[model samples]
Target: EPEVTQTPSHQVTQMGQEVILRCVPISNHLYFYWYRQILGQKVEFLVSFYNNEISEKSEIFDDQFSVERPDGSNFTLKIRSTKLEDSAMYFCASTGTGSPEAFFGQGTRLTVV
Candidate 1:
C-alpha cells in the first residue's frame, strides 16, 4: 500500500535558522495536512491544503511558516525562523475526505535549539 513518507526523520537547528521538512503524501489523496505534537501534548493541527491553496490553517501557522507542493509527490513545510517552542514532531497526513481517520507519516522530529 502507498504510505506517506517524511525525510530526515530528525532535525536539529539553532534559533532563527530556516528549516524545510519534507513529505510525500499518499498519491491518490487530495487533502494534505500538517500537524505537530509537542512532547507530552496532543497533536495540534497547523494547516491543511488542497487544490494548490490553503484550505484551512490554525493559529499555530503564523508568518514564519509556509508550505508548498514543489512537485507531483513532494510536500514541504518551511519555517522562516525557528524558535525553541517550535521543536516538535511534525506529522504529514493525507485523506480523501475531511475525516478523523486520516493517515499519518511516521513524523519528522524538528528540534530548535
Candidate 2:
C-alpha cells in the first residue's frame, strides 16, 4: 500500500533559525494537514491545505509558518524563525475527507535549541 513519507525523521536547530520539513503525502489523497504534538501535549492542528489553497488553519499557524505543495507529491512546511516552544513532533497527514481516520506519516521530530 502507498503511504506518506517524511524526511530527516529528527531535526535539531537553534532558536531563530529557519527549517523546512518535507513530506510526500499519499498519491491519491485529497486533503493534507499538518499537526504537531509537544512532548506531553495533545496533537494540535496547524493547517490544512487543499485545492492549492489553505482550507483551514488553527491559531497556532502564525506569520512564521508557511506550507507549500512544491510538486505533485511533495508537501513542505517552512518555519521562518524557530523558537524553543516550536520543539515537537510535526506530523504530515492526509485523508480523502475530514474524517477521524487520517493517515499520518511517522513524523519529523523538531528540537529547537
Candidate 3:
C-alpha cells in the first residue's frame, strides 16, 4: 500500500534558522495537510492544500510558515525562522477525494536549540 513519506526523519536546528520539511503524499490522494504535535500535546492542524492552493489554515500557520506543492509529487513546509516552541513532530497527511479519513506519515521531529 502507498503511504506518505517524509525526509530527514529528525532534524536539529538553531533558533532563528530556517528549515524546510519535505513530504510526498500518497499518489492518488487529492488533499494534503500539515500538522504538528508539540511534545506531550495534542495534534494540531497547521494547513491544508488542494488544487495547488491553501484550502485552509490554522492560526499557528503564521508568517513564519509556508506550504508549497512545487511539483506533482512533492509537498513541503518551510519555517523561515525556527523558535524553541517550533520543536515538534510535524506530520504530513492526505486523503482521497471526498474522504474524511487521513493517512499520516511517521512525522519529522524538529528540534530547535
Q: Write one digit per residue (lDDT tens) for candidate 3, span 1-113.
A: 89999988999999999999999999999899999999999999999999999999999999999999999999999999999999999999999987789999999999999
Candidate 3 clash pair list: none
All candidates' lDDT scores?
0.94, 0.94, 0.97
Question: How much is 42 displaced in model 3, in angstroms?
Answer: 0.3
TM-score of 2: 0.95
**Alpha-carbon runs more than 4 Å astray in model 3:** none
Best by lDDT: 3
lDDT of 3 at 33: 99
- The worst-scoring run of ten residues by lDDT in candidate 3 lies at 97-106
Candidate 1 has a TM-score of: 0.95
Per-residue lDDT tens digits of candidate 1, residues 17-108? 99999999998888899999999999999999999999999999999999999899988999999999999999999997555578899999
Global local distance difference test of model 3: 0.97
Worst 10 residues of 1 by lDDT: 95-104
